[model samples]
Target: MTRSRAGGGQKKIPTALNATYYAQRASAGLMITEATQVSSLSTAYPNTPGIFTSEQTTGWKLVTDAVHQQGGRIFLQLWHAGRVAHPLWHPEAATPVGPSAIAAQGQTFTPQGMQPYVTPRALEIAEIIEIVHQFRQGAENALLAGFDGVEIHGAFGYIIDQFLQDNANQRTDRHGGSLENRTRFLLEVVEAVTQVWGAQRVGIKLSPSNTYNGMADSNPVETFSYAIEALNSFDLAYVHLMETSEADLRHGGHKIPTSLFRPIYKGTLIVNGGYTKETATAALAENNADLVSFGNLFVANPDLPDRFRFNAPLNQPDSSTFYAAPCDDSTENCGFEKGYTDYSFFSQLEASSRAE
Candidate 1:
């Protein structure tokens, strides 16, 4: 199942509400939880979940246990936001760290509200190793939390994505310049991640041609090809490949098709991005994807697989409540409980209609 950041993040600590939410959708074949930060510094926005602390891990355990009780397999997406992070989350108001000191153009949501992006402090060599260790630790925490597996978040212009692309990484060390160099950090993290979960239980999420967060690689095909080639060495379970339209945002011509990497990396290929039941069927029938993930659709319909099985009408998701902050006003209420788990199943909807 695809994960959505709907009406969450306001609740700093992971709560039973989250467990209840995931349990409601536990029928999915394999569920990937929302992007979870590896450390406190990995937090880019307020209310994002973390796996660094005992409290956080224990909280996630509740989620994993709930899903397991319902006989669902789930994986946690371990993430590091890189330069997208704000000092508001930092202990001493420190600057965010990235492959380079370049500041991404745009504002990030913080506890105080929207804040302008700041030029990040370039991480030291030691810090780079530390980041890899942090990911390894995050995997350990996920194991303790009873996750079936873990997916490394190397997409969406996050920390790993920042280093993979040419525009964001401008370093002269062995860790930058050529495609091989740019892939070093990601490969290193994967190595660490594999140590905790093993390659068969590990997976990666990558956005090869995406330009989100002002990303641009000189040669996306070559860069991702090299990175994926290295990834193949690990013999992972699958590579969750995400694709996006370049028209709205991002550089053109960099959009590499999913088939391009199929031969390069021989493993399970899960595709995500605006996929519908029909399109996903076509993709599978055409052998373009091994699996397809849906986000908002799953949010509006907990029994999504069954809905597709029965060709039932899907609930239209409300955009206004997609990411709304918590509300206390009795007349105007919106939050995790409302937008997260309140979506009715087909049976519930039918029962309500009959009563009406």
Candidate 2:
């Protein structure tokens, strides 16, 4: 790989070593892969993994095989970054597509120093139809790669969320304009993906009040309730909600009334977004969520549940090695293997302490 460009290497591309990373954490009842691109055009960052090619599918198969060998369940997080995408990762090197021509107000890490996001090409109705096919194809590939199921990355101002939010989607066609129209695209994708993985195994991620990518709805409570209601028809395995009622407000989104959605969405509800072990336990006990997804806690402690059960002190995460982007596109180990599979397990650390 080439040298890290100035201020780059933020998103590490998953590699064969990722199999080791997942395997180490296979003691968990469930594991979810990092959000992987459905196609080259859908990629928002360099070195991100895609499921569209044989090579990528084979790489994923290695990860899945490793996880299953340990009797663990895992699901692939399917993503299309939409306007967060830049031309660098697009096939033929073209501008990224969005529900509308408006650009997201943020910078994306490129081979060079962070570049301002480009104004995306507004997707035509026909292109929107094509994306449904892409999601279906991605789910089928995930099945072939041995994923237990697939999680549609519909949250955080990506393609599906772009279509869902009124500020981002300015279309007058069947894909946009009203609440029903906005919800239509997501439902179609759910339908398409379920065709490959079945409704029982399919899940979705939603950020009802996220403003990470300039996302805000005129009526977030009503807007999101309509979307959640639509999912009830699908019998989805779960709905992963990013509880953003508390966030850095300067980023610009409103508080999502997370409590209001519990009745609207009848499926298994999973909550994420900066949850601590204590808060997670509280959320489940209070019936705020059926499951909680941890990020750094899981990263620093591979056998995370064990630590939680015994009231073990948690290991702090290393901020520097969270993600690695290869400057020259070389795939070997991505960048540094520090924050990934190299993170010390509690057993390993305890053994070292005894040896010392």
Candidate 3:
């Protein structure tokens, strides 16, 4: 691990990012861009990137160019915090909306101090369509910015997940009730995004029993099983699963194995959550997962795949600077704050593996 200039411990910033950061870690089979929002209303933090604006798309061009320069394939993760959003961080501060009006239990970080969540206004059918359009536009923007593909952020108790969960969605519209009804919103979203990027260039992520932001499902197994089958109809790039642990599982819910859903889903299955190098390797070796996504490991060690292959030591992440705005301030729209974008991948790998 490199020494932090802060003296005793690692600095709260990820210096290894940038062109060199991706170049150093160019060995991964695929690299998914960090979770990026689809619109201004989707903002949830100080430095997280959004795909809604032209400037944001331009900023991401630099990133994809760098990864490609290093011979790596990258996909952009399209996200919307849903009810997890804080009003202070958005243009409509204190007015963030969700599927239902139920307020989340935890405090949300905002420009102001942590504040209690307010009940989100239920989205009307027309508004729901608008949201889908936003996602479609984001997918188009991603392609315009030169991303290989886009992953719909359906997991982690986000907006789409909220609509999927019975506890979070109490409406009586086409978007609420019955497993089919609840998952309708997400399916529609996938369809909309696919229209722009094609099913092969699009994917979806889901958490069967995640409780983040107070999300819950009456029957996650049935709910997700049904959802997975529906996802298969689209023939998406992959169905990324976030397996819930024993503690995270709710009552009346069944634990689902990635293998069990394999038959239902005819596409690639990428599994995530609490996965280590050994576990990731075993998942691939055992055919349990087609790909494994390392969250923090990828965050701290950009060259994580190579590090795992060669058993190189890894760098721990800096929790403080993770959300801290970069000095250059471009982070207001994109995650990168400084001229961090100016840095390029290692030149040696590029010269040898440059794409035709």
TM-score of each: 0.91, 0.92, 0.83
Model 3: per-residue Cα lDDT over 1-356, one tens digit each: 11111100111122224435455556778777667778677655555667787767776777778778888888888888777777766664547778778876677766576777777777778888889998999899899988899889998778999999888998887788888889998998999999998999898888886777777777777888899988888888999998766646643334666666766787899998878998888889988879888766665666565556556566666555344432323232434533232323334454345432
Instruction: Write one digit per residue (lDDT tens) for candidate 1, span 1-356.
Output: 32333222323345677798889889999989888888777667655678888888888988999999999999998999899888987767778899999988678777678888888899889999999999999999999999999999999889999999988999999889888889999999999999999999999999887877777777888888888888888999899987766541444535578878888888889998888999999999998879998888988988898788767789998766666453333322335566777898888565456556
CA lDDT of each candidate?
0.82, 0.80, 0.72
**Clashes in model 3: which pairs?**
19-344, 19-345, 20-344, 25-303, 87-93, 87-94
Which ranges in model 3 have alpha carbons more than 4 Å from their true place? 1-24, 92-94, 245-257, 318-321, 325-356
**Model 3: lDDT to the true structure:** 0.72
Q: Candidate 1 vs candidate 3: which has greater TM-score?
A: 1
User: Residues 1-356, candidate 2, lDDT per residue (tens digit)?
Assistant: 01122111223334557778789899887787788877678767656677777677877898899998988999998888899988765656789999999999878786666889999999988888888898898899899999999999988889999999998998998888899999999999999999998898999999898887788778878888999998999999999888774552657666665656888888899888888888888888998889998877888888887677656677888767676654544546335566766766666566456556
Query: How far is 176's C-alpha from truth in model 2 (Å)?
Result: 0.8
Write down the TM-score for model 2.
0.92
Q: Residue 207 of candidate 2: its Cα lDDT? A: 87
Clashes of 3: 6
